[model samples]
Target: MSLSRQTTSRRRFLQGTAAAGAAAFVAPAANRAFALQSPNERPVFATIGLRNQGWGITNKSFKFADFAALADVDSNVLGANVEKAAAKQKKKPDAYKDYREILDRKDIDAVMIATPDHWHTKISVEAMYAGKDVYCEKPLTLTIAEGKLIEKVVKETGRVFQVGTMQRTESGQRFLQAIALVKAGRIGTVKKVTCGIGGMVASPVIPVAEVPKEIDWDFWLGPAPKVDYRALPEMRQGYGGGVPLYSNCHYSFRNWHEYSGGKLTDWGAHHVDIACWALGASDTGPSKITPLEYSLPVEYKDGNPVVHDQYNTATSFKIRVDMPNDVEMIINSAGDNGILFEGTEGRFFVNRGKIVGAPVEALKENPLPEGAIEEVYGGPVSENHTANFIDAMKSRKQPISDVWSHNRMLEICHLSNIAMRLDRELKWDPAKREIVGDDQANSFLSREDRKGYEINM
Candidate 1:
C-alpha cells in the first residue's frame, strides 16, 4: 500500500477498534489485525539477510506484512527462504543477492534487516535515505559511532525504526509486567541489576578454505576487512546446524570480535536493554565499566588479538557498571540467563520463562494500577516487535525500541567489551558519549569501512 493510503486506513481501523481496548489488553495480538483488513491497505515489506534470524523475524511478521522481495548473499539460503515465505504469504517475492535492489523499490514501504552485526548500519542508513522504514535486528550497530550515524539518519528522514528487542513487547508480557512492577514502586528504590547473558566457547584453529561457489563472499564481507574464508569440516548439528561448525561466517559470526562483540552484544543486547529500561536509565548510560574478571580465547596485545585463526572474543566474563542513582549493574556469563533486580524494599527475578519474587506474589492481593504496562511502554503496546514497528510506521512515530534509547543502553555492552580487551577500568562521560581521558579506548568507538563499500549517504 502507498504510505498515504496505509496511514488513512490504519487511522480508520484504530478508530473503529477503540471500543475493543479492554479486549486488546487481554490479547493484543488478536486486536492488532488492524493492518489485516483489506488487500490494498496491507503494508509492503522486504527482508535482507535470509539466515536463521533473518527468516525468524520475517516468518512472524507474515501475518501483518505483505513481503515483496527477499535478499541474501547466500543463494542457497535465499532460495530456500523465498519459497517458504511465498508459501506462507501466498505470493512470490523477487529474490536478489544484493539488498540495494529492495531499497531502491519505491513500492516497498519498509525493510526488515537481519544482517550480521557488521552490516546493520550501512543497510539501515541507506534504506532510510531511500525513504523506507526500517526494522533492524538488535545490537543495532557494530560500534558506538555507527549507532550515532543511524540515529542521525532516522531524524533526518523521519522514518520509523524499530530494534528487534521483543522482550519489551512479547514473551507473554512477562518483561512488560516486570517493568510495570518497578514503576508501581513494587521494587522500591532499585539498588542493583544483574544481567546474566551467558558466554561463548573457545574454537580451535579453523583452517582457511575455498569460498562456497553458491555464496557471494565479497558481498557477505562488505565493510568488514577482507579475509580468507575459514571453516571446519565437521558440520554443526542442532538448531543452527548445517553450516560449518567454526567458520568466520554464519551463526559463528557472533563469536568473533571483527564481526560481533561475543556474548556481551549477543545476549547482553536483550537483557541489558531491559535492565536499563527498568532502572529509568534508557536515555543515559553507565558512568564506568570495569572488567572484573574475563577469559579470552586467544592472546592479545594492545587490545588486538595476536591470532586470527580461532575465535578471539572473551569466553567468559564478569563486568561491573556504575549506573545512575548509585545502581550497581552486574553483567556476567554466570547464573540464570535473565535480569535480577534488587531494591531496598523488595526484590524480583525476571526472564523469558517467568517472573518471580515476593513482590510478584504480592500482586495477587495488591495489584498495580490499571494501564500500568501501557504507561511504562509510553503508549498501548502492540502485538509483537514487528507489530509495534508497523504501528509506528502508520503513526509516523518512533517505536518502543527507538534508535536513540537503544544506542544509549548498547554503549554499556560495547564499553564492557572494550574494558575486557584493555584489561582495565574505564571511566565514561555519558553526556559526551566518550571515554574520559583515554584516547586509545576512544579510538575503538568507530571503524573505517573497506574501500568501495562505504555507506552511500
Candidate 2:
C-alpha cells in the first residue's frame, strides 16, 4: 500500500477512537439521561429568587414539574429551600448562589423569576436568551423602559412567558366574574374604576444594619444604587410574603422608589391588572395621570425626592387616570382594598376573596353566559398561576397573564407614581410611550440603571 493511503486510514481510525472515548466519559446517570431526554419530557425548572413569593410558587409548582435546581442570593434561604424541595418531592435539586450559573446549564428547561421588582427585567431577558420559558412575578417591570426591554426580548425569543398575576386564575373566579360582567356590559359601560390599594407608610431613617452573614449583600443590591444592607426579618411568608419588610430592604423592598413603586406597584400590580382587563384597555394605557393629593415622607423637587434615605415613596395619595374611551380611574390609599367598577347601569366590588354588588347579585337571576369565565381564563380553568404558565409552555401560546398586557397595567401604576412624585397632573402619549410635554415627567419612563447591571434596549 502507498504511504499516503496508509496515513489517511490511520487518521480516520484515531478520529473514531476519540469520538468513542468522549461518549464513554458521559456515563454518569444524570448526564446520560439529560442526553436521552425526550422532547415531550416534563420541563425541569430552576428558581432564581426565593423568599416570600418565590416560596409560594415553589410549594404549588412542584406537582407540575421536577424541581431540578434552586438559586438565591441568601445562603440560608437557598439551603432551606433545597431541603424543603427534597422532603416535598423526595428529589434533591442542585443549588447555586449566582442565578447565571443555573441559566448556563443545558438541562434546565425553564426558570421562575421571583426576584425584587428591579431585577425582573434583567433576569427575564437573559433567561429567554438562554432558551428557557419564564414565569416572572409581577409587577412585571420596575419602569416603562424595562417593560419595553422585556417586550422586545420576548418577541425576539419566542419563549412562553407568564406574569405571576394569579387573580386571572382564581379558583372561585371572583375577579374573572367581575371582569366578565364589566366587559359584558352588565355595568352598562365601564365609565370609571376605583382601585383601593391602600396607602404607603414611610419608614423612618433606617439605621445602617449589619449585612446578614448568609447573604451576598452586593448581589442582593443588584442594579439598585449601592447602599448598606438594612437587615430585615423576612415578611409575609404565608401570602407570598406580601411586602416582606416595612423598613425597605429584603422583603420590604417595595416601600422605596429605588427598588419598587411602593404600594402603587405592590397591590396595584394585581388590582390594576384586572381593572385594565375589564376595560379592554390591556394593550394601551391611560392618556393622562393626575395626582389629586399625596404626601411623601420627604420633600421633593424636580420629580425626585429631596431626602435620599428613609421610605421615599408616597406615604398616602389619590391618583386619577383618564384612559382611552373617556374612561376614568381613581386609585386610592383609603377605603377597602379592592377594585370597584361603576358604570351607567350598575356597580360592583371585587377582590381576592369575593365579588359582590348589584351586577354580581343579579347574576343569580340573570346568570352570565356559560363558559364566560373560562374564556377570560384563555380556555379551561387553570389550577393556579404556575399551572397556566406550564400549560402555555406546552401549547406554545401566551399565558393568562402575558407580558404585553401586564406591562400596560404596570404603565398605569408607574405613571401614577410619576404624577404623585411630581405633585401634578401629567399627560401621556401612549403611542409614543412618553410623558407628553413634560420632559422631566417623560424622564421617569425609565431609570438610569447602575453600571454592569444595565438592561439593554
Candidate 3:
C-alpha cells in the first residue's frame, strides 16, 4: 500500500480499538506481545507544555502507555489537553502548572517535554536528575553550551533521552533509499552537501503592554534576561488574546531569538540533521562554519539592526561548513528547503514529499538493497514513533533519535546561527568544543540568564 493509505489504515484500526475500550481489546494484545510478568504492567507517562506540539506528542505517546500527568503554565490550554488525554487513557491524570511537580512524582516513568527552546535544557536535565527518562523536542537547545550540559547530565544519570527529531523515523521509501545508496557508494566519494533552510523577515515594532494574569510571565521568561512581558507578543497571542498587545503569545515566537532560533534552527533541526545523519556524522559535526553573505533587514533597535527585536534572524544567507575528512557542505536559505548530496559519481536530492536522482528511475523502483536501511534501525517494523519511545523506556535501550547523536547534529544548527550573527568565519575545535581565536563568537555559545532563574548545571 502507499504510505498515506497505510498510515490511514493504522489510524482507523487504532480508533476502532479505542472506541471498543482499551481494556477489552488493546491491553490484552499489548500484554501478550510484551509477555507481562504481572497483569498490571503499564508505563506511566507525564507531559510538560500542554499546547501546540506538546498536545500531539502527549496524545501519541500516551497511546502506547498510561498518561499520569499533564503540566503547563497556562491553565486554559493545560486543562483542555488533560481532559483529552484522560478520555483517551480512560482515566484522569494529575495536572500541574509547574513541570517540577510532575518530575517529583515517583510513579511517573518518563516525560515528553515540548516547551519553548529556552526551557528545553532546564526541564530535560532536571527530569534526568530526578530519575525519569526524557523525550524532548528538536533543535534540543537554545545555545550550544546548553546542549553540552544536557549531554553531560544524561551521561551522569544514565537516562534514556530521545530527541524529537521524528524525521529519523518517517523518512520512508524516498529518503531511506537515497541514504542507503549514498552509504553503499552509489554516490561515490561524496565531497559536498547542500542544505537549504529559509529565513525570516523583520517585524514591525510595538510598544510594551500588560502581562496576562493567566501567565506567570516571570517564570515564562526563566533563565533569560528580564525583558518586560510586553516584549513578547507571540506568547500573549497563545492565550486567546488578540495581537497589538505588547506581550502577546502567539504564532511569531519562532522568528524571535529569545524564545526560538528562527528558520536556521527551526528547519535546520530537521534538514541539517538529515545531512549529518546521511554523512555518518551524527556523533560529531562540522569543524568550521563561515558566514558567506547575509541580507540584513532594515530596522533599528540601538544602532545595530535588531535581528532579535521582532524577527532579527537572517532572512537570506549562505554559510559554508567544513567537516572532518575534507567534506565541505554549504547551507543556504536561498534555494528550495531540502538537502542535495553531490558526489563524484551521481547526486541525489530528498525533501519532505519527494526524492529525485540524476538517474530518475533509481528512486521509483530498483532502489537500494531491501534490508540496508532497516538494518540501521534493528527493531520491529512499527509506524508509531511514540511507541518506539515507550518500548525504549521499558527495554532501557536508546530510542531511534538518541541524545548523543541528536545533540551533535544540533551543534551545526546552533553554530550556523552564531556565524550569521557574528558575520564572520569561525574555526571550531569539535574535540574541545570551543570556538578558536574569536572571543566574541565564543561568547555567543552561552547566554546571560536572569539572576533567580539560571540553569544551575
Candidate 4:
C-alpha cells in the first residue's frame, strides 16, 4: 500500500515515457474512485505554491494521488508542507525552491497551483505545455487578458484544466442544490441575484522590512514588480497566520492591486461564479459593469494606486452588472456573506452552511427531478473538488469547473475591480471581451510582466 513499494516496472515505464518526451500513463475512466490498487496506479502530483490554500488542496488529495515533488519560493513553507505531506502519505517527497523544477520533471502528471493571483496564469500555461494537467486556484488570473492567455494555452496544449471554485462541487453540495433549484424552476424566472462577498479593512502604512532568509524574495515577486519587501512586526492570527497581517506579501496580498483585486476577485471569484452559473451566463458575460458606489483605501491617478505601502484595494463596493436575460447582479461588500437569489416565483438564500427559503423548503413537497443535481453538474458530482479533478484526469476531459467558464465569470470580478479603480462605468463587448471605447480602462487589461520572468510559452 505504500509508495515505497511501487514496482520497478512502473518506474521504468514512466522514465521511458519521459525520455521520449511523451506524457505519463493516462488512467482510464474506470479509476474514477481513485482508490489505490497497485502502487504505480495512482496519478503523480506536484504542488507549486505551498501556502495556505496550496497545502490545503494537496493535503486533501493524499488518498488519490502520489505526490513526488513540492515547490515554493519560501523555504520555510516548502519544508513544512513536505513534512506534512510525508506524514500523511508516508512517502517523503523531494522539495525545491523553484517551481520550474517541478514543471521540468516529466513524471509529474498534474500540478496544483496556489500562487498569488498574479502567478496563476504563467504557472498554469507553462504546466500545460510541460505535459501536465493543472488544478489552479481562483481567481485564476489577475486580469482579463491573462485569462485569455490561459484559455489559449489550454486549447493549444489539450490539457485537462480545473479551476479551484470548490463551491461548484463541495460546500456540502449547497451550491449544487442552488443551481439545481434554478434549473428545476423552483424559483421561476430569477430576476436578480445579490452576492455579498464581505469586505476588507484598510491597513496602516506598513514599513519595508527585511526579507526572511528562508524566502527567495525575487522569485516570490516573479512577473510582479520588484519592490522592497514590506511587513509589520505584528503576526497575523487564526487562518493564514505566522505572516505579518498588514504586509504586501502572504495572505494580505489579497488587499493589494499589485498582487490581487481585493474582495471583488477574492470572494467575488467564488460567489459571482455561482451567480453566473445559476443565471445560465457562464459561457457569456455581462454587457456592462457599473460601479454604483465604492470606497478605496488609497488615492489613485490614472487608475494606478498612489500608495504602495498600504492596502490600496477597495474597502467597500457595490457593483451592478447587466447580466443576460435582463437579470441584474449586485456584487457588494455589505450584508450577509452569502448569495440571495430573487425570482418571480420565490426566493432563496444559500451559502456554505445552508440553503433555505420557500423554494428550498418546498423541495419536500415538490421535489427536483431525479438526477437533477447531477444533471446540473453534467454528471455525478465527486466527493470533493480534487476528486473531480482526478476524475477529469482519468477521463481526459474537462472537470466540472473548467477554465473557460471560470474565466468568463471571473471577468465580472476583474471588470468590477477595473471599474472601481478608474471610478467609471464600463460598457463591455462580451463578444469581443473588451471594454468599449475606454482606452484608459482597457490599458488595465494586461500588465507587462517584470523582465526576465516572462512566461516561458
lDDT values for all models: 0.87, 0.79, 0.72, 0.86
Q: Model 2: which ten-residue window has the lowest total lDDT?
A: 1-10
Report residue 22 deviation for candidate 2 (angstroms). 40
Q: What's the best-to-worst order under TM-score?
A: 1, 4, 2, 3
The C-alpha stretches of model 4 lying farther than 4 A from their native spots are 1-31
Model 3 lDDT, residue 14, Cα: 36
**Tens digit of per-residue lDDT, candidate 2, span 1-457:** 1112222322333343344454533343222221133323445778989887798887887766678899999898899899999998798999999988877776777799998888998889888877778999988888899899888888888878999987777546788888889878899977889999998667756666777688898888789889876634445555535433545567678878888898999899889988999888999888899999888888889878777657888888888899889888999999999999999999999987778888888988999999898677656666567766765665567888899999998999999998988888998888888888898888888888788887533
Candidate order by decreasing lDDT? 1, 4, 2, 3
By lDDT, is 3 or 4 better?
A: 4
Give the poorly placed runs of model 3, Cα more than 4 Å off: 1-39, 231-250, 298-309, 363-366
Tens digits of per-residue lDDT for model 1 on 93-196?
A: 99999998887676787899999999999999888877788999988988999999998998887888999988787777788899888878888989999999
Better of 1 and 2 by lDDT: 1
* Candidate 3 lDDT, 17-106, residue by residue in tens: 344343432342233222132324545678998667788777766546678899888777778888888788789998899888887676
TM-score of 4: 0.93
- Clash list (residue pairs), candidate 1: none
Per-residue error (Å), model 4, residue 119:
0.9
Better candidate by lDDT, 1 or 3:
1
